[model samples]
Target: MPAADAEVLIVGAGPVGLLLACFLGRTGIPTILLERRSSRGPGSKAIGITPTSLEVLAELGLVDRFLARGVQVRSAAVHADEDARPRPLARLELGGPGAAFPFILSLPQVDTEALLREALGRWPAVRLREGTEAVEVRQESSSVTVRARGPSGGETLLRAPLLAACDGAGSPMAGLLGLRRRVRRFPVAFRMGDYRDESGLGPVAHLYFTRLGSVESFPMPGGLRRWIVQATGAEEPEPSFEKVEAQVLARTGQRLDPGGRVWASAFRPERTELERFRAGRVVFCGDAAHTMPPIGGQGMNTGFADARLLARVLERCRRGGENLENLLALYEPYRRTGFRAAARRSRLFMGVGTLRAAAPRALRNLLVPVLTRPPLSRTLVGHFTMVNVPYSTLSGVLARERRLRLAGEGQADEASGG
Candidate 1:
């Protein structure tokens, strides 16, 4: 009932939180985004932005900025590792005339964050407070309050009608809300690094499924290419340029020149989802809500979808003076269903590459060529690009809202006409 610090308080200034704040600000909703990190770190973890997420960026009028800076990867080539040489198995063409964005935009995750931050400058109502971490979250009957510790170690209390948790997989807000999480860890681990593009791969992404392990290569923007290799380890291994070069040469016969290496890291993949995306006045978005293996590049794009829909639903609720909780309640089921579908897709995508055995790998190499041709290739492209994901009926809810608005406008016009 009383005045709050902002209409909405967003915890985390990652891609999801930044985009959500931008969307809310576009609709005239005041928002405050909090980031625990004092500065942006260097990494290109999530690089592929699906066409569906591109549509959302286009709506925000920020797609051109991304397109101008990103690499348009139009296809991905799957190969069979034959001894030290890789034989082409199948190639997936990713875009068509029917699609608004025919190709996936491959940009560094850090660059993506920077672009989002730059776009935030247009939305004066959205405030990004870095080095401010949410220490405590309290959701009352009418408002949600958060106690944050600033860079100076001073604590500040902020309140809002709504709080969005975009704080990532290890989200503290999820813990503060006492939400249950379901986690499943995969047996696989991988090492990936960016290097100078010397394989003549162009903008095509390449995947080599060998008897030893998988080796994936994707082209990047600045004359660099990303290489990911499945590691043989019971524990997570620290990545070295030597490991990458040796494995890549052994599996694909393409030697990586270490002189042009950038950054390298190792990770064990896992899937995590919250029991629910919301708790009273608080709601989870981005990695805070769900996370899958980074294999398919679905993690950040899924969060982009979350921010897109949340923005529309929140704007509708505020403009129509609707019950915020009830509307959000309606929004959650759709997102949950969408996340489940995305998780399954991510699993399938990762599983295909991690096939180590000979029998299954042989079968895959045989079927991939057939599947990546003609009618079937269309479906494969959809799955790879994430354009085929329905993201549930959240769009239908907004569509109904649009129809109601048009009807109301027509009624007002009739009443005004003598």
Candidate 2:
């Protein structure tokens, strides 16, 4: 019950941690955000930002900054190699009048982090220490203490009532907490890069399902486009501009002469989620909690949702003098369930897109058109854009409201002697 260094000690300064710090700081709660990396890295890791995430940013008054720097994707087309003229198997329209931000936005992760950092500057209570790595953490009955090494190899201890872990997939904190993880790796690898887009694809995202594998292309904010191709047989092949260009040509019969290549890398997709999202006083968020395949682009957006909800819970506890433990107890189940659903959806997309057999591929290509019409089409769009994710505290609020309403009605009926 003694005074701690800060109200919350947040590990990692990615989108999740940065947004959490901003939220807590705005609520007048002291926060310390630590980042091992001194600077943001190059290239885009997660490009698709969902409408729900935009709504969360709007609540924080930071959505317009993102809107100005991102490209709006209104439609997506899925093409198969069976057609001779590059006909689309199915086209999903993302823009509609029902939603506030009708379409998904494509912005590089680096840019997203920079904007978050800028937003965090408005709050004077947040202390961000870059190039500081957390090396040790200790949890006591009433407080948590973290030992970190600075840039100059000096050690310092930081204590707080709560700890938020957003350190990513290879989180040392998760290991230190001794949480169990379930992970599965895909058999295939992918090569992805950002290139000067001269293909005239506009703002439409394209996915080509060929005999070899799948190729995805999406427009970026600048005059660039991101392309991801499945590298099935090449075990150690280098991901260069030529490899991606060749794959596109072989699959879709469309030649793309990329003007310049900015970034390229090969990676094997893996799905990972922890058994639980909390341990003692430490709570997991973002990649620290769950990691999914990049097929649906739900990874970062889901993390943003986690940070948003956790901020709300923490703020309520801080202001109302509520028990922090009771409020935080709701976070893990809500977020874990959402992550399971997202991982399942992502896995299904990966499986369908990477089908190379004739029977399954034929069935998928034939049924895609029919399933992508009317009601079914809307569901597909919702899944891809993550608008359908129910990872907020709204569900709990609605349930509580329903119970109160029922009780009031019962009292009214009793009073009437009915």
Please tell me which predicted candidate would have the highest lDDT against the true structure. 1
lDDT (10s digit) by residue, model 2, range 202-278: 99999988887899999998898999988868476576778888887888776776667788877788888887798
lDDT per residue for candidate 1 within 1-418, as digits (tens), equals 5579999999999999998998998888989999999986666688999999898899999999999999999998898875657788888889966889999999999999999999999988999899999999998988999999999999999999889999999789989888989999999999998998889989999999888898989899999999999998797678778898888898988978989899898889889999889888888988999999989889998898888878887888878977766678766777777777788889998899889888888788888999899898888888888877765335676676678889999999999992
Q: Each prediction's TM-score against the native?
A: 0.93, 0.93
lDDT of each: 0.88, 0.86
